[model samples]
Target: MSRISHLFSGTALAICLPATAALADLTAEEVWADWQSYMSSAGYAVTASEVVGSGSVAVSDMTLTMEMDDASGGGAFEVVLETINFVEQGDGTVAIELPASTTMNMSFQPETGENVTVAVDFDQTAPNMVAAGDPGDLTYTYAAEAARMALQGVTIDGITVGPQIAKLDVTMTDLAQVVKTTVGTLRSVSQDMTIASVDYDLAFNDPESDDSFQMKGAMQGLKLDGTGKLPIASDVQNLNAMLNDGFQAAVTFTTTGGNYDLSFSSETDGSGTANATSTGAAFDVSIGPDGLLYDVSQTGVDMNMLLTELPLPLSFSAAEIGTRFLMPLQKSTEEQDFGIAVTLNEFSMSDVIWSLFDPTSQLPRDPATLVVDLSGKAKVLFDFLDPAQAAVLDQADTVPGELNAVTINKIELDAVGARLTGSGDFVFDNTDLATFDGVPRPEGAVDLTMVGANGLIDKLVGMSLLPEDQAMGARMMMGLFAVPGEGEDTLNSKIEVNDQGHVLANGQRIR
Candidate 1:
């Protein structure tokens, strides 16, 4: 019976041993230490006081700081957290709680040698973290909370400014990261955050005057999703190596496909008040390793100003407007590519505004439309963000890069009873700046077609809006460059600049 009992006991012990080996005992102190070391490896100076308990650890008086030195002058920033508690769970997980707020202080000086200081306050709820395997990989999930951020102090050029308050309601679904303790590398990170609303109040004193200004702004329903892979290592130093070493990240932000509003109003001590309001404004932006993509639109906008010195208030309104842009992320020695598109649809004016420019109302009351699309390539000499490189370019009195080529992919205008459409391509000669008075000389052609131009000009002349001599000169200039089109009041022209720096219309040299 004794032998049988020993055999059973040994068998049970073997089963338990395997299960225990699968989970290495992790303490709250160990995790906190690893976090501190990881941040230090990433070029931040960190300090903290720790107190250990049975299954938890509390860190107090934590501080992290970094500094930057550049042509725009040097700057430093520091963050201080009052107290943070890390509690270990039975399931091999840790919970981080920061019941107190955090403070960040930043000081910087511009090239003009003027100093500035900005202080901020931030707070968040506790987040749950689970360690994966023995490699220090952490997967964390934070509960949505109404976080508050405030700008406590701002000093610019030695002038002190008043405080600003902001409330941000944020929720994060996932915040996962792989942190290697041995090499101190944050290999990968992914997160999704939603901001329900952001309301702010700002006040500042004019540096050169005795007046003060106050503004209030608010934004609603913003969401951000991002994932990134970093090439960070313990030994990494420069940005070039960090970016070139298989680094890639993409982030996208939107408003949940719903209409949002952003509005602001400002008031001066003695200069009255100004207000601007926008409705149905939507924003979407995406960024990746290679490029950035953005789309912004607003359905309606209104602005009003009441000045103490002016007899009447100024106001204006627009029906719809938007813009889109896509550009490369990194600068290269070779040609870099970029594109931009702008659109203004259904633009209308108030009666008060119209009376100022056209009291007789001779122009048509139709809403105007303006659209443009442009793409181009350019060669960069150095990194524009680098202060040293920018200083060199500034001292030489030259642009950081030279345009290689540009294409007017599309241009359309429908306004004032006239419509114009055009497409063009041009190549710039960087070596011929002197010929164009410090501007790059272009050698290419653009073809344009206009409809209703003649009738529009006739109306202007009949209404006494334009002098007869000026109208005749304009017609003669059009006759010299453009030929009559097949349709009524239509004209077509090709505008060009030759290699010899001569401007031409059609096949004839005009200059």
Candidate 2:
């Protein structure tokens, strides 16, 4: 309700608002009072007119406003609601009714960019929200049959853009949400949300040029789970101090299936159309006192594209794709853990795409795969969480961290008729950077195996894809670095960097 970041919690579609419950049978007045307290604690300036009745309280002309300023810039946001009813159910529960329509306005002034303002309109079909539990630990549950959001207006440096220039609409159906809040030294919130279906359509047109674009998409079985520790004492404008004060969060989002279609036209770039579909996808992110983590994955993806500049259509597919990264953000004297991984499985292109190069079908057509996993440790010289330090580091020539050690957990690649695999570990000597031309000198050994190399080269040569001289040069290089194995068309090699600053291949010194 207060900060811009809260807009991302769980069902981002749900306009974030603060409210609490009670231990005893809750009254309409108590519930309304707790709602004000929760809003103030979350750093929102809340004001409204209230009409008290026998068993209900009518709130009207309500406005919640928040402002944040930092090194980068400053921004202000306001939410206006026409009416909300708080009715005490006779059975120790409070039933909250939200207005059918809500208005949100945002104005931002960046230090280096033009001022911008955005206005959005939110509408829902009779959302049923209820609150129960004690004041210390309150729970709220909400459900709605349908909800919609429309972009009302946008202004950049006093230039207004109406719906004719840019338009957006997002709709959701069968929505359910639950939030649990605990009050203590800090406020802790846990959220779980699910939406049966979602549909979005957007369009943009340039008034100056004949450039235009439109996009439409739909998704099913959307879900989100998230937890966070909020600093109820002060506004979260200073993220570095907030993180230091025990602020942490984790959020995960998933969807069962989705599809999208996109079209663009411009005088400079020409016209194109793209469409894609996927069976499932997932995204996860977490940040705590120690470090940060990010992971994303998608499965069963298919895409098609048509461009006026190109004569043929392009299509591709992949069974699975994934990537992950984990690292520490705080300044540390001791080495901290960090890791990165990537995977692409069963990736292939349509025959029409392949025919562009290998029309004769001289090379074997097979799905390609690639996988890599790496872990390392580093000593951080500057804290990334601190904005001031980040600014200084950005202007410096050197990086903010020093690599201490690295391990290649796995590496595999399979394409066409060739395959390769390897693994290794290494430790760096940071004090002796001159030995490796200002880089930390590393000492390690890696064992590699390859199959079908010579046969693939021969096929390429036969298809005229590789010149005879180039094929001969490639064979010479492979022979110099590798030794023939017992199996046909197989090669094995051991690459090593010794403590004496010597690089070796197959136990023979190369440098």
Candidate 1 lands at a TM-score of: 0.74
What TM-score, computed on C-alpha atoms, does each candidate reach? 0.74, 0.91
RMSD of each: 11.6, 2.9
Q: Model 1: residues >4 Å from true position, as ranges?
A: 1-43, 52-55, 70-72, 100-137, 152-186, 205-210, 228-251, 256-272, 280-299, 308-311, 319-333, 384-388, 395-400, 429-441, 497-503
The stretch of ten residues in a row with the least summed lDDT in candidate 2 is 10-19
- Which pairs clash in the backbone of model 1? none
Give every collision pair in model 2.
22-134
User: Model 1 residue 449 lDDT?
Assistant: 91
Best by lDDT: 2
Q: Write the per-residue lDDT of candidate 2 for residues 268-306, one digit (tens) a residue.
A: 899999999999999999987668899999899999999
lDDT of each: 0.62, 0.82
Error of 2 at 168 (Å): 1.1
